[model samples]
Each structure stands twice: as structure tokens, then as C-alpha cells.
Target: MKWRKEEQTPPPMEESAVPDTGWATTSMSTGAMANWTAVVRWSAWGLLLAGPLLGGWALASARTPVTVPTRAEAPRAQPASSDAVAPAGFAELYVAAYVKAGDSDADTEELSAYYPAARSMSWSGEGGAERAESASAVQVRQVSAGYWSVTVAARITSSSKNADSGRVRYFQVPVRAAGGRGASGWTAAALPAEVASPTSSKGVAPELSYGSAHAPLDSDPAVQTVRGFLAAYLTGGGELDRYLSPGTTLHAVRPAPYTAVSVTQIAEHGQGPAEGAEAQVPPDGVQRRLLVDVEGDGKHTGSRPMSYAIELRARDGRWEVAALEAAPALAAPGTKSNSEEGQGS
Candidate 1:
């Protein structure tokens, strides 16, 4: 296969009402009205003080409208756990693209501008000036209506800033898988606000190529088969593996060590990429997520590390990369804006 190589890289609320008493019933009258007067006077004071104070308290606790981000949220992608090795293909592609795009002098503002959800590429500086560092787990929390946990980590260096200023202020965020076993579908509600993009890319679909026979795995496959592929891709080396056919050895493993692949999410699945093609709908009426990851590696010997995807396809009873491309890695995730943005002692 022709490899396009490049290098470069809790809440609560309460309410109550005060009873009113007539002023006519006054205790000074030396009649039964005396107690009533006290009640009336006290009630008045209570109302006077309670109105604004109670109202303010209620307002404070009121639920505000969920402001949908002006720019869509970052697409949720689950970081494969250390033991959970993801399908090998796209990790390479994802990392490559991420780094190349991030490290270059190319106006990142444009990235923030062109795609609003892309604003996540900056680090506020809470990371502090690292005298030295290593790629540690960033954070994996729920962002949207999905079920997967996202992770943000970094492969740091011993310098003042990481990618910039040698402080190494960058985030490599990853989303966790949402769906349950025997169920290989997802929905918008299954994710956090961080990675879901409401907008769809128009015009051309990625002209991805699947190789021959054992190669170009058919996009049109049984749902069970697809699920198996995803499971394998996620686990790295496991049952029903993706990149492996028969006789494929573990040594074939290529570690994108410095590459930080964030949010490995599933895109979409259907009958199209294969012969008898059309949108492959889950009989149970579930949506299939398309998986993608972005990271970079400029150290690789090349002009610049170009990004490529290692997609999944089901062929001859197994899943494999349909197409192959080379790309750079992306900047790390959970990056802070300033020293105190998300800093913790």
C-alpha cells in the first residue's frame, strides 16, 4: 500500500407561607384581640423580610436553561484504557493529524474560528512550569449523553513548557464508550457535552479504500460482526481482533508512543461502503457511532507527519482497516487556559 508519510508534529429548595392576623385584635386592648395583634404585627414583619429574601433564594436555586454551546461541543471519543488497547489503525492516523495541526504556526484561531467546537486545543497554564514530565492520565469524566468515559492525558517532556513555552500546557482528552454489551449502537443522549457535534460535514465522504480480498473488509456485514470489530479495536489485542487475520503476530504491533490520540469515537455504520450498499440500520433501531482519533508525531523521519485513518471493515469473518494513511498527532487535552483555570493542588 502507498503510505502517505509526512512528519512535522447536588442542589436543594424550600418554601413556606406566613399566616395573616387582623390588626383589630390587639393585645393592648386587654381582650382576646391582644394575641391577634401580636400575630398580625409579626406576620407583617415576616412577609416584609421573607419576600425578597425568599425570592432571591429561589432565583439562586432555579435551574437555568442548558445553553447549547454556540459552537458544537467537541465530539466525544473514548480513550482506550491502558489495558483497553484500541484498534491499531486509526490511533496512528488520529495522533498524526492532531500534532501536525496543533504544533504548526498555522493560525489556531482559525481552527477555533472555522470550527467552534475546536476551541479545546488551548492550555490555560494550570499545568504549571513542569521542570520535567511524562504522559499521565489527564481526566476521564462524563461530558454528554453518551456512556463512554473520556480521558485527557499527555506524553510530556522535561522542559519548561510542553508544546509551547516549554510549560507543556496541553490536553489529550478521550471519551469512554457508552453502549452496553451485545448492543453496538449510540445516540446523542449517550454522551457528554464535550464531544458531540450537531453539524454534519457536507459534500464528499472520505474516499477511504479497503484492500483486496482479505483486505478491503466489507462495510456491509452483520451487526454482530461490527460490534466484534469495535470491541477488538477498543481492546487492542483481544478476541475477534480488527487488524489481525490469520498468522498476524503481536510483534506487528506499532506503538505510537509519543502520539496522543484523543476521543476515539465511532462515526457511523451502514451497507454503503460495500456492494449492496445503503445505510445499515440496526434492526432494533439504534444509531452506530463512527470512531475517530487525533494525535501527532513530528519526530518520525519525514517532511511532516501527515494524518490518515485506519478504518474498520468486516471481511472473511473479521474486521480490518479498510484504508491506510499517515498523519501527525494532536496537542494534548485537558489543557488549561491560565495557571488557575482548572488547577488543583
Candidate 2:
């Protein structure tokens, strides 16, 4: 009974501002195109500026010199000398010929081979005769590269009535050498000059490590071993290896030059085994150095005396000869054996 008419209003119409919308889209596109153009221009300029610099750097690297390291080479060896033996021998022979010539003009022809300009020589006496027994070149020294001075020792015996027996004299000769050792050439530079003998120190006594007070008794195993070894070595009585240590090499004298040998004295470097301890076994790896004086009864000749510096080592409680020492050890200056002083006191 109360239905009134309901009315609905129409929806609003869409706006038609097409040009404004198109203008807004076109403006955004233009701005984006300008940004891309600026970026491309910057990249092109950057590449153009760097191109010449990179090319110049590459050219400079190609033109520059390069050094590679290498290893150094070793020096070559020099050839052997030729002047050693020939000049020394020639000088010795010349000295012998000079002594025989002895102030005579007729005998000068012998000297002509050596001196070439010799007419005569000088002598102290008028009517004495001198002869050379033996001559040997003892020393040779280089004055320069190829020049040498050879000293010859000559034994001269005079036939004069009151003159003494044969005497030793030294003469020096100058020589020049050329060519190789196989094919040699030599010339005498000057005549011989009589010089003084080489210096001597025979009066002085050498101090050795072995002392007189350290003599070991004959019963000691080391002393017995040395005695037995010497007997075999000199007279060929037994096998030398029986007393020799391991790795030791020795040979007995061939043909048995002697009939018997006796050990005269033995001087040990340190304290020896206790008295009557010879029967007991010594410690293994023990070592002792000894100076042994020996006399050999020769088969045909008289008794000959000799000395040996020896080393002995112990293994399995037995002593064996080790080595023949090259030289006896020396004692320091102002050092005296304490055992000697103890015995004296």
C-alpha cells in the first residue's frame, strides 16, 4: 500500500583530455632520450682520450731492451811447465866440468860446451890438482818467468899433499829455458858462483810427546804385541796379520833381511796397564800410542838400530797394532813430564 517509486542517478562520464595525457607521456620520453644521449657522449669521449695513451705505452714496451740472466763460466787450467828438470841437470853437469878445468887454458874446451866464452879459470894454488867426486842439483828457484837459479852441491877431493880430505861445496848457476818438456832448449846465463851451505838446525833437539818415565813393562800386552810385530816385520818370523788390527795393511820385509830383532825400549803416551795385570783382559776399545826403539840382527851386516812411532787399539780385550804413525806427537814448549819429576822427588 506504500510502494513509492525508487530513482537511480546515471554514472559520471569519462573525461576526454587526450592531448594533455599525450603531452605528459612525450615529455617523459624526451627526458629519458636526453639522459641516454649524455651517457653515450661521455663514453665515446673517454675511449677517444685513452686510445693514444694505450698505443704509446704498447710501442714503448716493444722498443725497450730486455736482459736475460745467464750462468758464469769456469776458468781453464794452465799447461804444465817444462823448465823443472832440464835446467837443473844441465847446471849440475856444468859445475862438474868447471871444477875439472881449474885455471888451465888448454882444458877450457870442456867449459866451452857450457860457458862458450870461457878462456881460463881462477884457483888459489899454482900446482895443486882438484877432482870432483859427485855433484847434484839440490835447489832450483825461478828468478823471473823462464830464468832459473840452480844450486848444485859438489863433493871435491884435492890431490895436493897437505890439503884435507874430500869436502862438500855449493855452487849456483843461472839458466834460461825454452820449449816444452818433451823437446827442450836451455842456455847458461852466467858462470857458477860459490855460495854458503844451506842453514842447519841439527844442534837443536825436538821435544816429543813420549817421555822417558812412561816406559811400559815388557809384560804389558801392548809391549809384547809391538815386540812380536817387529820381529815378524824385520825377520819374517810369523804372520804380520796376527798382530795387526782390522782394516790395517802391512807386509813383512821380503827375503828376510834379518835373523832376529829385539825391542830395545818402549815409551807409551799415557799410563799403561797395572803391574801384573798383563794376564787379565784389558778393556775393549782401548787405545795407546808408543815409541818403540828396536835393533835387528842382520843376516850378513852388523846390528841395525831403528825406531817406530806406533798406534795400538784393543778389541775383544786383545791388543792389535793399528798404524805406523806418520810423525811422533810433539810436546809443547816449557812442558816437562810430570812422571819424571814425581820419580825424582
Candidate 3:
């Protein structure tokens, strides 16, 4: 049997229309490009103008240097329990009053100020008659916290046949300090005890820097300057300004104590202006230090010997007094010095 064939047909798609946008998009892109170019150009101009201004500002600020302040260091704090200072003065006063105490009511009252319980003098009431001329604390040592031992040197005069010839005696006083850090009261722990003099090694004199063996002669300009300056300083015989260095201030002895002053010996520090160079003045700004020995004669007091440590500066080819040294300069230990011969020369 023959079957009938069925025909299969495909369905058609629906159609929709789209508008063209190429022209509008191209126009918008061109406008954005122009705006970007304008922004780049403005930024380049701003950089070019601002670079010189910033450079000028940096250079102007760097012209003057700034000085930084230094920070000060704080001092170290001391412990509260330690006795930072010794009671030397207090011990001297107490010992002075004790040595002069006698058998009188006034003595008891004065002694009570230091030792409240002191009813009588330490010695027996019989023939104890010694007085102190002067008392000074020479040495102080701390034995422990709030305790010290002070050695006082006193010039004592005795009533029995030795008033004119007073002797210096050493007395050790035990002192006690109370409160914190030595800021409070001081008291004597006990009565003073007579002690031997402090022991020291002999032949231990300090070596000074004046070590030149060749003494300056009278023709030396520096020696002449010193002689003239000393004459004015001790005797007021000449004007001080004529011999003083610039910026040096020295006053003559008031009332002109001496009639004449003569420089006896001069010892120079270091090798002075060569051997023959001593006749000619040293160059400007050259300095010389001399240890000079002199004698001063007064109208009534007679001749008195004195020594001076002086410094001289050269100006305008002449020497001028610079300074009267407070003390002679010290040399290294074990170094040989001619300072002993300074007095003898």
C-alpha cells in the first residue's frame, strides 16, 4: 500500500530597523580630544612659570644660615643621705671659744653657745691661762655620714713668760652635721684634742715653668719694661699708662708707699729672644714671661724684698706690661726648673 507524503515548511523571521550613529559619535570624540589638548597645554605653561619662582624662593631662603640653639645639660642630683660639705668653719669657731675659756661666769655663758652642757672649762681651775690669737681650719675629713674630723691651726699665747713668742698648735675637732645634704645644723661631737702637725715629704717643691738659666740683662727691653712698670706699680714714680699694654688695667699702690724700687734679678720662661736678639725688641705680638726679684726702699720702712710674676707683650717694637700673673705657670712633674736660682740671681 502507498502512504501519502507530508510537506514540512520553515517559518519566516520578524524584521526590525536600526538608526545610524557614526556621525554623532565621531563629533563627540573630536570634542573630547580638543579638551584634553587644552588641559595638557595649560599644565605645561603652569609648570614652566612656577619652576623659576620656586627656584628663586629656595635660593633666597638659603642666603642666611640658621643657627641652632645648644641644649644645656642638667646637673647631677646628689643623694639626700650624704653629707656633701664638711663643717670646717663651725669647728674652728667652737675650738676658738673652747681654748680661751677661763674661770669666769662670762666664759661659761660663751661656751654654752657651742656646748649647752658645758658648765666649766675642760681644764682644772688652777693655773690654766692660755689664750688663742687666731684659729683657722686647715684640714677637713669625713669619717662617716654626718660626721667629720677637722684639723684647726691656732696661734696660742701663754700668760707665763711667753706672750711675745706665740706658737701655732694643731687641734683635732670631731664635728657632727645633721639634716639632709649638709644643709642643716653643725655641732661638735667632743672636745678638741691636741695633735701633731700634718706630716709631709720634704724636697717636694712644685716645679715652675721659669727654667731658663740665662738671666735677662739690664739692656734687655723686656727687663727695662718690667723695671719701669714695677717702679710705677710699687712706688708710683712714673705714669702707668706709658708701660701698660693695650687693654691692661693696673692701679698703682695708693699713697705711694715706696721711695725707690730696683729690679734685682730676672728669670725668663722659655728661651727668650735668642742670645744676641735680647738687645733688639722682639717682633710685634711676641710675649715674654718673667719672674722678677726686686727690692723696695721706703722713706721710713727701710728696704724690703719682693718678687713678681709678670707677662709682657711687644707692640710697636717695644715691650709693654701685659698682666701680673696670679701664680706662676706649673711645669711637668720631675722636670728641672731654675726657679730656686730665681731668688738668688
Candidate 4:
């Protein structure tokens, strides 16, 4: 066992051998990788160069403006005149134009401006006489959006071969807007008609009638109260306070200083509920309408009869005058005449 231990030895180490194709393979692989990298770089540079050029060409083409032909525009219409724009003002002007006084052809020509061709003959013979009409009150109501009904109370004066006279008259006229663009003027559809016939005689009584259900107005206590108030009002007495409702003024019934008025007869028109009746009462109160026939005597002229419509309302067991529409006097002087005051009831 001692001799065997002395003879043991390890094998000698050997170096690893390098292949002969190693350098060539390394060079080929490195060169191929370099070439691939160069091609990719060139491709990237080509894309970068082409992208901006394509985008610039597209943007330039898109931003280019195109020309187009256009037609000329038409002019806008001018607005209508101020006179034509206002309906009430036009109506007043129309009435004034037709009512002006003259005997010359110029007056007829002036009136013709307001009339249509068909109505031109209405004023044909108006040039031969001196006729004047003046409106003191004008009340207009619009019946529709395009039409209006006008009531004009006027004094008409004329000088003729027989006599020179003046009178009060009411006219009802219909007005409508003219058709067509930029034509805002309102035209009278036709000549006006008289609202009421003039009184024929002096101191003549009006025909009195009543509904079947209603009693005579003279017997009604409410009507008697009104009659007493009216008599006091016409006599220039200021004792109408008890007969009038609170805050009621009687400007329409003020007596003319130079004229004497006498109420001859009173007639009731419609039926009203009896006093203190609980059934079918109006909201304000029980209202009664009386048509009073009056005779007015001027200082120089004799007496003339006229009719008036008066509205009365019952309050606190008494009647008060609510409204009055009195006819004008027949002996009223012309507008040109030298008189202290015009005759109005």
C-alpha cells in the first residue's frame, strides 16, 4: 500500500483550439448588420424628406381659393310716409280734406286727391257752392285689424240762394287699409251717412212708447229723482249734489247762459229690475235709460225741440245721471259767425 501511493500522477491541461472560419464569419455578420442599419437610416431619411413635401403640397392645394360668379342684388323698398303710417291721423286728415270750404275748382281738385276714381264724381258739383264743415269730436273704433269705424260730430255751414244756415250733424264712416306693398294709407270705403235725422219742428213732442213689462217712466221714483236733478241743472242751480252719486260730475248737463232749456217729455226704453229685488241684478246697479225731449229758446231765436238720451243708475235708493247724449241745437250759428258760444246740449 505504501509503494502504490508513490506512483499516482495527474494528466496534463490542453488549450481549446480556435476555428479557422471564425474571423470570416464575424466579418460577414458585422458587415451585413452595418449594411442593414445603413439601409434603414437611408429609408428613414427618405421618408422624412418626402413627408414634409407631400404635406406642404396638400396644404397649399387645400388653401387655394376658388372664384365664383354672383348676380347683383335688388334694392330694398323705402318705408311708407308718416301720414300714411298712422290710421287715426290719416282718417282725420281725410275728413279735413273733404270738409274744407271753397267754391273754386281748386277745392274740388284738392278733395279729389283723397277719393278713388269711382268716387271722383261725388265732389263734381261741389265747386259751385260755398260749403264748410268742421268736426268738433271724432270717435274711432277699430272693428278689425284692417278696418275702422269712425263717428264724427260736426257743424255744417252753407250759404245758398234761399238762406244762409248752419246745423250740427253726425257722420258714420268706414275706413280700411289700402292694398299693395309700401301702401300703408287708409282709405274711406265710401261717403259717410247721417246718424240721426234732424228735428223738423219747434216744441214738438217725441212719440213715447214703453215695453210691455215696464211701467211709465214718469211714475218711477228713480226717474223722478233724475227729472228733478235735470230741472235744477238747467236752471243754473248747484243743488244736484243729493241726486248725483259720489264723485259724479255733470259737465255735459251744464246750462248755457244765453239759452233756456225745458224738458217736455221723458220716455223709458228698456226694462230694469225693481229696486231691492234680489233676482237678476247688474253688477254696478240697476240702470235705467230715458229719452228726454227738450225745447231750447235762444235770446233772439224762438224755441226749438230736440231729443236727448240720458242714462241713470240707482244707488242707495236714489237715481243719478250716469251719462248724457244730447242733440245739438237747430239754431246754432255758423263756425264763422261772431257768437259768444256755439250751441251744444
Candidate 5:
């Protein structure tokens, strides 16, 4: 009574036909294959056309000039002390070399070294060949940055037998600092001229009386203040504004560079000549003159003795310097004490 045997089912076929419409029997005959072939042909033609363009571009790039950045050249350097102002003591040196009464050929030659060749020749030819007995008292003043005025006192004796004894004369000369081909540093800028020429007196000179001995005024408060001020001023030590008057020309009295000066002695002088006359008493509150001796040690100028005539007055309960001058003792006819000569010497 079992059911009848189940019927058997057959498997699907292994090979099947693909439908086509007006194409070859191969897979490459499809629309996709045609697009691929068209693209390949276009690529080959593009390669051929682009090759020359790329090569021309490379050649043009190589032929073009390249601009490499460069650095600018550095500027030249200058001297450290190139300021236009002349150095210290140059005016004095110029005066000493340029102004004199009479000079020999050798002396002129030596002096000529301080001037330009052309100027030296002119100076040598102009009365500088005569030799003189003595020349002294040279004074120099700076007129400007590179210019100076010099005054020299000298005595010249004539070569003739009948000629009178020489008289003291003052000659004024102008000088300039030169930086030329033949001359450098200080040089004589011009020839000298007679400013004051006074003859010697024929009569006998009058005798002078010696004054009473005076003692140092260091005990006085005013003198003490002045001593301290001078010490500071000459040594470049403490500030001097407190002791100096407003608008005071302290710079003029300031010592030379790299110089240290110490006050050695201070003596009070009466208000008149120290000899041949009674001492006149100065009025109360009037400034008094003091003779001060100082010793100095300098860089260029070695240690030496110096004397100064200092005047001071009392103001605001403090003493202040009013004026200063150099003092040297020289007793002779037609000769007077000159501060410039004292300092320059």
C-alpha cells in the first residue's frame, strides 16, 4: 500500500547561447571594447602631440635666466677719533714753532717741518734766516676749531757794528691745523706781523722796596673753601657745582686732560703791588687775591710746579672763585707779569 515512486527531475544544461545584434562572436566586439579602442587611439595621438609641447616647455625653462639673490656690499669704516675738533695743546705747539724774532737756516729748517713745504719756503725766505739772541713769552689762543692766533715776544740784535741794542717786540701770527699731502697735524697757516714793538728805556730804572712777609691764610673759612674747590677742580675729583657760581666759566680754568694737581701753599696778598707801596686794605665783602702753589702730574706734561693767583668772594654764606691767573716772578724793565706766559711756560 506504499505510494507510487516519486518522479525524477533532470539538471540544467551546462552551455548556453548569448544573444547578439549585428556583432562578432568574440567578447571584444561589444560597445565597451569599441570605447576602449577609441580611447587607446586618442591616448596615442595625445602622447605624440604632447611630447613636443613638453620638450619645448623644458627647453624654454632651461634657456630662461635665473635671478639669484645677492647681498649688498658693506660700508667702509672710519677712525675712532675722527671728530673735527682739534686736539689739546695743538695751538700752543703751533705758536712755539711758527712765531719767533730771528732764526738761523738750521732753526728755520727745523721750524719748517711744522708747516707745508710751500708755506715753509715762504716762511724761510721772509726774515726767518736772521739769527736772534733770544725769543721768549709765546702766547696762543684758539680762535676756532682748526684756527689759532699766536703772540710772541722776542729780542733781535742787528748784525751791523753800529746798530743799536735790540728791543722787545710782540708779533702776532695766525695758524691752522693742516691735513695736506706734505704737512699734517699743526702747521703755520700764515706769516707773523708785529703787534707791539716798544723800545727799551734809556734812563736808570727805579728801585722797589720789599714788602713785609705775609703768612698763609689757610685758617680763614673762605680760604679753606677756595683750597678745597681748587683741589677738586684741578684733580677732576668731586663735583664742583656747589662751589662754582652759576654761569661760571669753570671749564676755562679746568686743568688739562689726565692731569692731577694738589694745592701746596696758599698765601694772602694785599690789594696793591707787593713792593714799593703801602698795602691798601680791601673793603669788607670785597674779593681777596691768593697766591697758590700747586704741583701737577700730567699724562703728556710730566710732573711740574705751578703757581696761580686766585681771587674769591663770599656769597650765600659760601666762598666761590671769581677769577684765576698764573703767576711767575720776572723782574725786568718793560716786563710785566702775564698769566698766559706763566701757564704756557
Candidate 6:
């Protein structure tokens, strides 16, 4: 019987007044837009004009040589440690003062003549190559189990300074021992006036074999010359003088003379760095790699003809054989035949 009426409330309206936070507001007019456009265009033009100039300046700066400080006094070179380990390939040792042109470094002929029968001449591997010479006084004493202490009286001929000056380097190697061993420990050697029984023929002469020469090595002119020597050496013999680097090494093969009658399988060669930026067998420039299989009939005995390593190099606008590490005998053709030998000819 007692029904009550309820009153409804209306929703509030959104206020249009400003917020309590404080900030600045701005607007762009037509003139302002034009000004901004002008600024952008001017900036683009400026960048375009400065681009080439800045590039040129950068290039010039790069080309400019940098200043390096020079030492006031002469620079001294550090000598190798005597106690250092000998090179792995060190095969023999010889105490000599000079390495003459015709002298045999492989056999120590010059050394033998100089220091004849003073004491026993015992040698093993781990001694670097030795060149026989005519120095004033030279003695070789074993410093370590595998090392030798060579002392010289500071001779004028064999010194590094004389050799660098391109002079006729004569030298005398002084003998030294690790202990306070006096001259008694040093063996005396005699010097001969002339080299005896020199080999005129290439068939028996020592050959200089080379691997491949890469940068900083094959680029050297001396390395090129040595390669040339190998080329002449391969074909029995040619102009040895045309080749033959100043420090060219001489190799000796046992069982008497090592002869190279003919070299074959040159086409089987690969590429190496000894060549000067060119293909193998190029008329001029260097060759990088050479895999040579030599074939020759000599005093060597085997089931087939003897072969030797005829490593080659192409540098200084020429192809040259660089190595002959002794060739093995060629086996009979067996089941295979020489049918591949003949071509269009």
C-alpha cells in the first residue's frame, strides 16, 4: 500500500577550461612555411657544393706523406743469439772465411785444403750451411751439442759490411769455443793460393734449386737471377752467368756425379708464388709455382731412368728451374704405355 517514488540525477557536462599544467603552444603561418622551405633548399645546395670540395681535400690529405721521426745516430742491428736453436734444415757445418765463385761449399774442398788433418772433421745435422774461404784465421768449435761457435779475427773480406758494399769479399773465420778454451782447442788450417780441380761441366756441378717465391721474396731481383740459373741448369747447361744469384746455394748429390740428361712432365707443374704475377712458362714476368718431374739417365742405379726435383720459378721476366733435390728412378711403363706422348706431331 505505501509505494515510494525515487529521484534520478543527470550526467555532468565536459568542461572547456584550460588544464592546470603549464606549457607553450605555437602555430606556423604561410610565411613561416616559406622560410623553412628556403632554409632546406639552401642547406641542400650548400651540401652539394661542399661535397666535391670536401672529397678533394680528403684525397689530398690521404696522399700527403706522413712525417716519421729519424734516429740521430746510426741504428744498430741486433745479432742472433748464439744459444738459439739451430735451423731445422741445418745439415752440415764448415769453418771457412770466404765463399769463392769456383769453390765447392757442398764438399768443403776449400776448407779441407785449409785445415788439413789437424783434427777429425766430424759433422752432423743442425749446422747451417758453411762456405769455404781464405780468411786469415778461422776455427770452428762445438758450442752446444748441435751448435758450433765460429770465431774470426774480424777479417775485412768476409764481414757483412764488405759484402753489402759489393766488393770482392775475402774472409777468415775465427774459431771460438764456449769455454775459455784457448787457441789449443782451435784447429789450424792452411790456405791454398788457387782453387783446385774446378768443375767446368754442368753435368757434375752443384745446382741451385728453388721452391716458389712469394711477395717480398720472389720480387727480389736476386731471386729472379737464381731462377734463371736453374733454367739453364735443367737443359744440361746454358749460360750459368746469366742466372746465378750472388748468394745462390750449391747442392751436392752423393754416389758421384748428378747428371740431368732431360727433364720431362713439365706440363704436370702447378702454380706457386715464385712467379711474378704471371702464368707458368710466360715469356716475361714471374711464375708462381712449378711441379717438375725430371727424367735422365746417369750413373744412378734403379729399375728405370733417374729423375730429380727440378723446381722452377718465374720472376724478373723469365722462367727458371730452381731446385734439383735428387730424382728417383723411373719405373717401367708396366701396364701403361707412352701412347700419351705423341700429339699433333
Candidate with top lDDT is: 3
Cα lDDT of model 3 by residue, 1-345, tens digit: 999899878775444322464444433455687898899999999999999999888877896866576987787554334344458877888888888887677776776666556764454552337777889998988898778899998888877786454888889988776443332366667778999887563657667788554444877888788888988898888899999998999899899989999887777886556667878957889998888888899989878988789999999999998999998778767765665555568
User: Candidate 2 residues 1-345, lDDT tens each?
Assistant: 999999988886555323554345543565687898899999999999999999878878886756565977686544335533558887888888877775555567667667766754454443227666899998988898778899999988877655454888889999776443323356677789999886473666676776564444766778788888988888988889999999999988888899998877777665555557766777877788888887889868888888889999988888899998988777767886534654588
TM-score of each: 0.19, 0.57, 0.65, 0.36, 0.33, 0.22
Please say which candidate is ahead in TM-score: 3 or 6: 3
Candidates, ranked, lDDT: 3, 2, 4, 5, 6, 1
**lDDT, candidate 3, residue 11?**
72
Q: Lowest lDDT 10-mer window, candidate 1?
A: 182-191
Candidate 1 per-residue C-alpha lDDT over 91-157 given as tens digits, one digit per residue, 9 for 90 to 100:
2222222333442334344333222345446533323223223333334445443433433233334
Of 2 and 5, the candidate ahead on TM-score is 2
Tens-digit lDDT track for model 4 on 1-345? Answer: 456557667775444433576454433555687898899999999999999899878777986665565987787665454334545655555556566524456765655454453234534344425343666436777788777777766666655644434676666767777654434355677766658633344666432332222233554565566556655666454476767766777643544442566667655554335444423323457777666776666667677776667777867665677766454223223332112122231
* Candidate 3 segments whose C-alpha is farther than 4 A from its true place: 1-86, 117-123, 126-128, 142-147, 162-165, 178-185, 199-204, 212-216, 338-345
Residue 17 local lDDT, model 3:
24
- Of 3 and 4, the candidate ranking higher by TM-score: 3
Give each model's clash number. Answer: 97, 0, 0, 0, 0, 30
Give the winner by TM-score.
3
Better of 3 and 5 by TM-score: 3
Residue pairs in clash, model 5: none
Model 5 poorest ten-residue lDDT run: 207-216
Ranking by TM-score: 3, 2, 4, 5, 6, 1
The lDDT per prediction is 0.36, 0.76, 0.77, 0.58, 0.56, 0.40
lDDT of candidate 5?
Answer: 0.56
- After TM-score superposition, the amount by which residue 233's alpha carbon in candidate 1 deviates from its true location, in angstroms, is 4.8
Q: Identify the runs in model 6 with alpha carbons over 4 angstroms from their true place.
A: 1-238, 241-260, 264-283, 299-318, 321-345
* 40 Cα displacement, candidate 3 (Å): 76
Provide the lDDT at 63 for model 1: 92
Angstrom error of the Cα, residue 16, model 2: value is 99
